[model samples]
Target chain A: MTMFTVLEGVAAPLLRENVDTDTVIRIERLVSLEKVDLGHWAFETLRYRKDGSDNPDFVLNQPRYRGARILLAGRNFGCGSSREGAVHAILGMGIRCVIAPSFGDIFFSNCFQNGVLPIVLPQAEIDKLAEEARESAAGGAFAVDLEAQEIRTPGQRTVSFATDPNRRRALLQGLDPIATTLQRDGDIESFQQRDRQARPWIYG
Target chain B: MPGQSLFDKIWDAHVIADLGSGTSLLHIDRHIMHDLGGGRGLRRLSELGHKLRNPELIFATPDHAISTEPGRTSETTPLSSGYMKVLREETKKHGVRLFELGEDGQGIVHVVGPEMGISLPGVTLVCGDSHTCTHGAVGAMAWGIGSSELVHVLATQTMVQAKPKRMRVSFSGRMHDWVRSKDLILYLIGRLGAAAGSGSAVEYAGPAIRALSMEARLSLCNLSIEMGARFGMIAPDDTTFEYLAGRPFAPEGRMWDRAVSHWRTLPSDPDAVFDREESIEVDAIAPQITWGTSPQDVIAVDGIIPDPASAANPSRRHEMELAQRYMGIEPGRPIAGTPVDRVFIGSCTNSRIEDLRDAAAVARGRQVAKNVTAWVVPGSYIVKCQGEAEGLDAVFRAAGFEWREPGCSQCVAANGDVVPPGQRCVSTSNRNFAGRQGPGSRTHLASPAMAAAAAVAGAITDIRQLA
Candidate 1:
């Protein structure tokens, strides 16, 4: 059974724009003969220093963001290459909701298909949320409400955002185009049967 | 009082019977596949004990993992031997058309399809790779499908999909010199903030589009996925027809006339309505560059890195800080003159004739910077042959840029050649995400001309300066 909800948790707080899939997760990792704990390598290069030690300067390592679930990212958050491993790593890390100024075209679709809810907010709102996350890091536990489209911090400082109506409907219903299409199984099967009969040379 | 946009016409035409749950079965005409992800789909087919339902409708090629190094003993050694062999074997097993290394059709899957006249106008095309949208330049409805979905398409020759809302992105006015389609796409991705086209298909229209060469149109449509669009397109016009006319698969004689007639009528009716519309003036555009990790983190060539401290939004602040740290950039710093260790000009995005021509123009009399290593790869065998015939290879060689074999080299580091860790590269391919070129290799997405300029300058120099 699939979990019914619009989103889960967000881990990426930095909203750098044009984040291509190749960078989100490197191809080497994809071909690696290693078992992956998605979170273990979530920004593997950034989190690791030159000598393979933890880079204390990285955002994810900061004490304030120790357990942050929501990731706030810049526009085109997933761009470049279309390796789905980027989405897999993010989803595998147990992140459920990603609030971004925008997402790469293919990565956005991959997120929804993998059960991650990608929320888009205005640049201004994104800036505010990141600030709020930073300021309330000491307070511990920043929460986002998908239903209300509001991200609230400990001090009750809230930022509101908007998702595309159609996308929002799809995410909330947990219906990908395939699952949604299967709902019309009868019509599709009939069409398929007709198409096969008409183009018997092409269809099996 | 609503006017129809090109996107709306295509979307409505492709709609099969709608399933009640806000999704429908989309009728696909042509499906393109590449080695990287198609292997899994083929494996799944074997698991199901089913032969491909419609092998003729599908075509597969090896592009992603094929090593760029010439004279390599085999295609398997550089990457995972098992996966590469899987790709080569499955296409044979399924009896789909295969374009291996020795085949003339061999190139980036996106480039191979159109160059061979396989991607026709008004057809719904799907590839296992994301850049399949490149075919949309010829007015085809194309999108990338995942591994599991690829298996579904392989088995059923159809995909269950939700109808996307349509968006018309019209470019008005003339483009300035040095502002190619790559810059225009980067500009759009920057302006619309990447997700602007989410859940929608964008149709490129207006005077600017009609004026572009078919190759330039492909470059523009190729990056639609970067902007969060399922696909992007330009209505089939004379440029598209002319490019397809002499190609191998394109209909000849009277059939050609009929095909053109049908393609001419493929545009959206004036009365058709789009869910959204946006317009841009090419005159206002500039050669663009991506400053941060995402495509939306872009600004004009003369722009500066955005400072998160001064940002108004919380996410922007976080993004700014992260970008600054990851990219080793400081606040309020300009993007120009950023030193680059390497330059790469080739990919599905801008490795065609026009892109090579633009780069060759910059390389004509100039030499590459001694400190910079550059590679210029053609989009396809045809493109490579044409460039060699035109002496673009000599111009590049004279400028100290290595002329590379056609494939997606260094685009995703799928092939062996990648920027060494911590090295910054100016690349003509799309995406400037952190470590995109390789692990710990920083990539800055730029136009081929800009990449050539960077090769000459050994840094991120604006192409306009050279112009």
Candidate 2:
């Protein structure tokens, strides 16, 4: 587990709504790929044309957005599939944080597990950040301090956020959750013993 | 406490530790995995020097990455075979139970879990696939988890989870014969967009849900994940108990009685208050089909393509326009007569024997329309054998449909089984996301019967009208 403190980098705006995992990292690219920089295959259909050149129409393909470490995306980002490959692709692209109005429950959780911070902000705030990102693609950097629960815009504007305190602590300390669960092995043992006796059917 | 919703009851019971603010460490009763996603978790566990805490609670099978071709072996498909090889080797090394191809228990994780009675009431089940919600129909707290958590659960038979808000969707009216559970869910998603159930665990109740068989309830809960809900469930009832009675892994005799006694107490109390409540009138739900990329981009079989100008807002209008261009369907054209080039009638969502019977009923005496390729992959080897014994496979074969073996076939298109680029396919799988089946392929999600009807008609047609 990698500890997260703050990420300060260029924020690219991917404003399309309902950006499903299939679009995030198409299932085709995810099937037999090696453990490499999957960012090359992220958003395969949208980022590349049939001839294999960059689809100039895609936001990520724009030269100004290169090396972006923060993503300002639309609602329901990572909406389909329980694929962590989507996160692998997002991180592969060097994106360390994502700001969205909302996200699919599983995708949001996966981001945290993979050391990427998923920040839920109001749509108005995201729209504002998206605007700032486009304006500052060359010289501006968006900074997010997970410890302070705040996102710093390119214009040095501060916006606050909220997260479950323990998850936040875990992220800050880079603690594996299973290790955290292991600290309570006695309780888990008690649960297993009681659960088995109480409901023996599921055991079969 | 006495009036708690089933969601609350399950969540409260499973919490091993409350890591404040709504997060809790949940004791996982069952953790299932498959070929495509399970191998990485095993590698991570080995790397971390963590022996599986409870190998007995873990089940593995090769479904997502196995070929559904008859007589297919690992060598037949290299990409899928590689994943299956990893699954076979890892499960063997770990002493985890695995159902490989040609085995009786071999099937899609969801189908095999419930069919083997491993997914029972009052348990918390997690799987590496989103359609794992299908097992929630048997009154369990079941949902999908990603690869990262799969490793966590493998290392420690528990995972930390955040409590989601509770939602109850009541379908108060009686469904018509042609309106299967698939139609009801499509109608729900169509009426409410794909994100309607986001961040909530939905419980399906009311007369319509209760009237459904265990298979139908599974179909409904399966798509609940499609709408962005991590999980969905129906309270266990006599229907569930009866369905699990004689299954291979189900308990027998007095144990069955004790299981029933516990299951009957798992329903939500009458006075329970849901965080959110929704109602759907099912009497008027006709056979439905998707016209565009999203499952929510659907219409009744008789309806026409939606005009973007009629959209309520610019964002929605933009969505309509995108779906229109991608699907190559013009506005105002009736969806019924839209020609289809392919038909796929199998997926975790609708590949059970009952689902096969639905398609078989439609394809019994009809030949698949010329130039339209169609296939029928059973949900499991058990289902395939049963279908053959009951002549359901013959009905499909007689209709010019290729009767294939069991696995997650073209549903995910992992095994080189894909709809060609620019081809129109009516499929029974859940998601209609762009490029979900294949790049540049247009998929119109439908019920098994509806997909079968489309195969014969060479176009989308209401199943009721076909009869």
lDDT of each: 0.76, 0.88
| Docking quality level of the chain pair in candidate 1 | acceptable
Off by over 4 Å in 2: A137-139
Candidate 2 clashing pairs? none
Deviation in Å, model 1, residue B325 alpha carbon: 4.5
TM-score of each: 0.84, 0.98
Task: Compose the digit string of candidate 2's lDDT tens values, residues B137-170.
Answer: 9999998999889988998788888888899999
The Cα RMSD in angstroms, rounded to one decimal, for candidate 2 relative to the true structure is 1.3
CA shift at A71, candidate 1, in angstroms?
Answer: 6.4
Model 1 agreement with the true structure over B341-409: per-residue lDDT tens digits: 999999999898889999999999999998899999888778888999999999999989999888888
Top candidate when judged by TM-score against the true structure: 2
Per-residue lDDT, model 1, residue B130, is 79
